[model samples]
Target: MKRTIPPLLTAAALAAGCGTVSTSASSGGGEDAVTVESCGRDVTVDGVPERVVSMHPSLTELLVQLGVGDRVVAQAQDALGEPSPELAAEVDAITSISADVPPTREDLLAQSPDFVISGTEYEFSAEQGFAGYEDLEKAGAPAYVATAGCIDRRSEGAVADTFTDLENLGRIFGVEDRASELVTQAEQDLAEIEEIIGDDDPVRAVQVYVEGGKLYAIGGAVEIDVLRLGGGENLFAGDSRFDDFFAAEVNPEVVVDLQPDAFVFAVNDAAHEEQTRAYLEQTLADTPAVRNGLLVAVDNTYVQPGTLSAITGARIVAEALHG
Candidate 1:
């Protein structure tokens, strides 16, 4: 996967002058330590941050799962309206910062957040137009980028990459034990899924992310790796990365050309789900998947790279394939 540069540093630099420090005795009887390497920067935060700002819904969800949702003071504007019922209560206390527009230094300063957690570094770099790494350093609040959104193909060492991220978050929040428990459960769940599907005939499937009336086929390393765990074959296994395909990509003449036995649609919103369902119903009318009514709709977040992909996503695929 190609990596994109983030814009956080620019804004961080401009907000650089403020410094507020508070100290607390460590429960371990040593100096309280909260240090993390995120977005290529080593950040040592002092004590558990009382006020945290999550710049993406994914981060918000992760924090909530880690039992730190109560600390979040602000969230991205895009995440403000009508969250899933499961997340609505936590979001009620979160103030909105428009991610499409760079958050002003004043806006961030007013939140009095000691830490900022972004879903992707690119959200700060490309979307928010931050200047450089120092920008975050200057803001008196350390910023941590979610590794799940890290585009570094080289750093994705193993399935452990996802587990390590959970541990990293635990370290940041002084809840390392809780993080470990979640990672252990997640790993066990994935392992059980693998055992259940062991030796089964691989079901050929295709995952299409729909946006703006177009279908983008997911492939290359990510989907293939995940599908293999779910005991299924990615129909686009030969492709190296995700690619946008046209009507021609949907060949109708050769039955084998329409190879997938199941279809998964990654829908971004409720409206997108309706649009995708309509598009698939019309275009894939003759495909075995559609003819057999085996279309599956998945949340956009689950299909995208994330910590939840291994367990939650694998379970979804296993059930779909088994069904």
Candidate 2:
């Protein structure tokens, strides 16, 4: 199915008045106003933000990967998934203001943060105690959403956008140098696989997520693009067989017919992972991917757009399909 750029980021452009960006202390500083347009709003970062609050896991994880998690004093506990051991320490120290819901306005105000980072637009609803970005600006705390995390829920989660978000954060925090280092490292990690798989024919595959006996395919461009970059061809990309790219339920018959060479399973926990494996093995036993033992299990974060997850996930897919 064809899709348009989300209205939030439709033809959005970045304008840094000074015409120069610094990787070191050259943040959105000086007399010139730093301009960034996100989800349909133009944001002028008047100054660097010190005290920051992250409202979702992806934002927190990004900060952690960028070496700035220590600065995020508070966040949504539920959104924060299992992290690396070192990040666990950092996450443990921060205040968990909400369990499964966005922190109320009072909760946000209590933090006294200088900047706010939200994962989804839904988090900014009045019900979540956020009157949205304008309210945050009025409260004197400017905020930003990860490029892929805008109002569009077409379910697009892209790693490239994660880098963009990181660059934006670095500009807002005077840490562009650190962001560059992380991006460079990610590029290097991904480059190794690209070199090895360049000659291999692309593998046809359909990645899916499993939850409570239900199967959902992964079709977001952010994720699909990575598959392409990793040297795998997404069978569902304009295959015309899929009626809805965002369909919540999967038809095993479709998988059996497509006969994808790989079955990429995105699971969050051991139980879900085991269930997905069993379902595929029992129902798709005769399928090419299953018969050939090409089932790949990856963390849900792998499809959720984080620096480490994206690089790691792509490498996993490449090794599974090409190696």
> What lDDT does the true structure give each of the candidates?
0.57, 0.64
- Give a tens-digit lDDT track for model 2, residues 101-152: 5677788878887778875455555533454565677666666666765544
Candidate that would win on lDDT: 2
**Per-residue CA lDDT of candidate 1, range 1-323, in tens?**
11121111112221232322112112221267677666455667777888988775556767887899889888763321234457657755666765433355557656877788764444445224442234555555677766544434322323345565687778878888989888888878988887778778988787665444545565533334555666677676555332321111223333236557887765545776788888877866777788787777755444333345435556667777773
- TM-scores of all models? 0.74, 0.78
Off by over 4 Å in 1: 1-31, 77-88, 99-110, 126-132, 154-160, 195-198, 220-226, 240-258
Q: Which 10-residue window of candidate 2 scores lowest in summed lDDT?
A: 15-24
RMSD (Å) per prediction = 8.1, 8.1
